[model samples]
Target chain A: MKTEDLKNTQDYKYGFTTNIENIRAPKGLNEETIKFISNIKKEPEWMLDWRLKAFKRLQVLKEPNWQKPKYPNINYQDLYYYSAPKSTSEKPKSLEEIDPKILETYKKLGIPLVEQKRLNGIAVDAVFDSVSVATTFKDELTKQGIIFCSISEAIQKHPELVKKYLGSVIPLSDHYFATLNSAVFTDGSFVYIPPNTKCPMELSTYFRINASETGQFERTLIIADKGSYVSYLEGCTAPMRDENQLHAANVELIALDDAEIKYSTVQNWYPGDEKGVGGIYNFVTKRGACRGKNSKISWTQVETGSAITWKYPSCILQGDNSVGEFYSIAITNNFQKADTGTKMIHLGKNTKSKIISKGISAGNADNMYRGLVDIKNKAINSRNYTQCDSLLMGNKCGAHTIPYIKNNNSTSIIEHEATTTKINEEQLYYCNQRGLDQEEAVSLIVNGFCKEVLQQLPMEFAVEAQKLVAISLEGSVG
Target chain B: MLNIKNLETIIDNKHILKGLNLNIKPGEVHAIMGPNGSGKSTLANVLSGKNGYITKGDIQFNGERLNDISTEERAQKGIFLAFQYPLEIPGVNTNIFLKTSLNAVRKAKGEKELDTLTFLKLIKEKASELGIDEKFLSRQFNVGFSGGEKKKNEILQMKLLEPTLSILDETDSGLDIDALKIVADGVNSYKNKDNAFLIITHYQRLLDYIKPDFIHVLSNGKIVKTGDANLGLQLEKTGYTSLS
Candidate 1:
């Protein structure tokens, strides 16, 4: 085989850039850039003030270096904070009016944004570059009193809901990356399910980063009101480039009295080439709060891409009899590094939490699971169960798990289980002897290792996540 | 159905099967009885195309050169090896693994693969022959299974694949007498004029249930004696020491 052809085989299968003109903000993170972002969105004055506050707080916060994966310092002044497709400058009224190139991108990614070819039983809000181009099934969702639209539109049409929930979970002065997202964040999906309602279809958002030298800082806010239930899914992919792009998204979820929120993410951004030349630096802050009694929130993620990942989708069980659960499968291969897990905080009486994390590292990659389970003094009879399993492929890779458990209440209980294992050659041989090829054997075994976490995803996402689990481990086996 | 000539197998630079020779035809059941460290399992592994073995000499299966075929391809072309200890794969449902393995072999042979419903029906019948519980078929593949249950699973796989040549590597080592009968019954029901068996064991008891046409006494790294089924009974009276 030619060297070029062999190298292309290892490249991300979804590596294609869409050529489109983008109206970009000036390359900087100064107050002017923040004001420019706010004006471009035609935001209200209060929102602009909110952005300035976050930008002011961001100046004093130091970028955290405690993560295991380290990269060169980001030139905040050299990066474009906002890049939106020119056609989306005046928000398109419908799918017919949206730019065809943006629709084509989503179609190539197997998510048809067209009216007739839409995915069945699901509503999708396609976010291309730094703008939410089109959101489907809005009318149908509106009939059921569910608000599903882009955060930019939510700010315009449903400001009260946005104002009531935005930063209510992850506050403006939360941390470095999160505060940066709050200052100049672009478009992302926003969901609000009213009380005593069950969402009829799965609500989803597809994120694509196509602009060069632009950081995608999208913000997602979901609120499930009293006695309401909603399952929201987010998927992301990026075009392969030679320069590392930053994706710092802030996703905040809130569940009210007797409400349940299921949030799932299948993150398959462009991981760098074999030598780790360039890829997405995914530093995201995702947190959910069960704020009302008898509320529940579940987070399921299948993270398979990004050159370096620093993310933890955590949950706060703050209401009486509330529940929180996190199921994740993070696979890093070919010079990728991930320091990701979740935290469960029990602060209410009789609260409960469960965490199941599976990390698979291969091809000189490092995968770590750092988690915390804290039971406060007020949380009498609280219960927490955590299981962390790591699977390593080849001696060149590494897997690490760090679990912190604290129980201040004597009546509360926290149980932890951890196991570190290598992909057994004998198991692969046995499967091969049963007629499975080496690649197929590895895929099957790895899928088995991630079964528990995969089961937590929606049926539509579970099948795709299972295949991603296999594809992520390709070339790691003989 | 199978042929091996001067098959010298070395694992980790340790020559185990030094110049071993074997031949078997259709509808024939061959048993190899030996003491400990007689290279019994090595021969089975070599025939199954397992790794870590540096092999020299020719092995032909169904008239094709076996040395070049991969382990999965060998099974696709009708060579089956029942392992002594079935490796446990957690979280892989037994039924799903069986269906995948069966379909892989079937697809390689250019046969249409069976769908899930048909596969379930077919496997249910086969599992019933060996008395495997319906719940065990849904459990994780071989994980937390008893020694006898693991052996039964191997036989179930052997029956599902229906290979022309089947090699049993100490399958009766941990099976009780009742489980032995079930395994023997499974083998007996699957026996046909187009298929053959190569049973490797340390005892002659399994041979009594599923009698072999030829009994080969293996010692050190090669077969030292070859006779009919009656030889197993004679060797039982006096251990492998007499043959060596």
Candidate 2:
């Protein structure tokens, strides 16, 4: 990396530009570019064809007409389809060879990657700018028959596994963003825990989009085999930029018979400047499939940063006795916009699902919760419950909820409830009278409001996620 | 320890507390008795720095003009109000909330933060003294607690916070005899030579447990008359009709 690049990256606490070299393709997306990404990763022929097919479908797919997020016209031809870190002159035999600026960035973000050994039983895969830079605790995970690494590496090493389940639930034509992500996604994590293996450690990935003007399109997939259980954590941050960069990622999970997967995301991407000049436009598609009997999948996300975020990580229960759950806390401040929620589809006998969503809006931001619950005719005795609540910190901000439930079976019991409210000045006064400052009281109250979802995170990530929420909404209150 | 002279307050242009005047000296406990809609709670709220109330006149806490100070500032200056209906804060452990409030007060007083062991020991001792079980400390603050339990919880907070000028805003309204006694005993134990209390109540039942030095009849948002503790017994027997 050039000296100027390193200088630019260190300016942000999360984005530390790298100096190492990388193989780069020009910035643009097309069928050939998609083919280039697949060929460069040396993926199987079937996977390459899949990418191409998804690419063609993407061109024909129309932008979604749901919800009220103002997404600008994205020029696919102008976005860089692929990016990755430059390989080292010599493989990093020690931490000394790692870029100090990048490590310093993570340290400032409170995620010091160099202290992996001290993290204790948790594996970390750190992705910088469009590529997986370093993966730790791989040896330990490998001992337990678990694959924890980048999807690109997984495609090369575990082609059959990736091919068998990629896009199985969120197919190429599932939605506009999902199709676009499927076509030109660059890199994300892939994990598979074999049958009956209780994952010995929590798995995590720290993603940083550091490069300027480069759109990031990453994809992640996790699979838990029969009777297996795994918990995964994701964290994101970006550098300050003058123009809004697009980030459209896709994540898919598959749980086999009696398996369970718990996924958590703490997103604190760089919001625009205080005046709302520029930021990242985060659009993502994440879905899971409960394929085997009694399988379960749960998603918990704390969203605090993004110029505009449009995502609804969902679950499809296609097996008997399967379960799905979504717990989320989405907060926006300073002219940001977020439209996020979840969908649960029950298609099998005795399937069950629960959704709990909390949205907080402040500083002229607009936040919305859009969720769906669908029960098919074959879903006998299915149970679905959804509760969505929104808190507006100031009169200048906006919070809205749009929930849709389609039940085809009277045997199923689906309950939906939602409410919208503003943070009462009296509550703040009460807290302050107990000796809390304005910001501290707001943080305490908001955390209290989202405790249901924050508690769902693994113990380690829960603390990190809490700090992320505090940092994201630091200046949101009076 | 606290003084308010000709204090007037309005909410949304409606005068709620009109020229209310009362004085509380250190080592004294004054009970302000009133009927419903007499602005008993409004007086407590205005004194505690709750926003959205237009105010006139002045309040002095330990000689500091308190009209411009924030609620937390007043709390730091040793004012605690036991709410009539304590707000339920779900997901916040009772101990954590107590400790945070305590530490905030201590920090404002230029004191060091208490160690976890010391804090826990203090909590255990006080919780037992107030008849609060160990389990209550681990649960969310006042969540799912019965009305009497909620009042007791407020007293528990007052005990832990140990403010110099503690205001009990109808702290006896929902309490049973036993709970009321427990709450009054907690308040009585915290009283000292340099501390004062402003206990607002509609009934005189709590006075049997915690003795008051003076009683004031509040009507139409003003203190109409002031007398000794015998006045409380007389008012309870005669009702506010005679006082009005």
TM-score of chain A of each: 0.98, 0.93
Scored against the native two-chain complex, candidate 2 gets a DockQ of 0.60
The CAPRI class of candidate 2 is: medium
Off by over 4 Å in 2: A1-23, A39-46, A87-96, A475-477, B15-21, B34-39, B115-117, B219-224, B234-244
Itemize residue pairs with steric clashes in candidate 2: A1-A19, A21-A86, A22-A86
**What is candidate 2's lDDT per residue for A234-272, written digit by digit as tens?**
999987776888888999999999999999998878778
CA deviation > 4 Å runs, candidate 1: A1-9, A117-119
Q: Give the distance in Å from residue A205's predicted Cα in candidate 1 to where it truly belongs.
A: 0.6
Model 1 RMSD vs true structure: 1.6
Q: lDDT per residue, candidate 1, A1-478, as tens digits?
A: 2356445556687779999999999998899999899999999998999999999999899999989999999999999999999999999999989889888888899886766754477899999989999999889899999999999999999999999989998999999999999998989999999999999989999999999999999999999999999999999999999899999999999999999999999999999988988999999999999999999999999999999988999889999999999999999998999999998999999999999999999999999999989999999999999999999999999999999889998999899999999999999999999999887899899999999999899998898998888878878875
Tell how far residue B58 is off in model 1, in angstroms.
1.0
In terms of DockQ, the best-performing candidate is 1
DockQ by candidate, in order: 0.84, 0.60
Candidate 1 local distance difference test against the native: 0.93
Candidate 2 at B76: error in angstroms? 1.3
Best by lDDT: 1
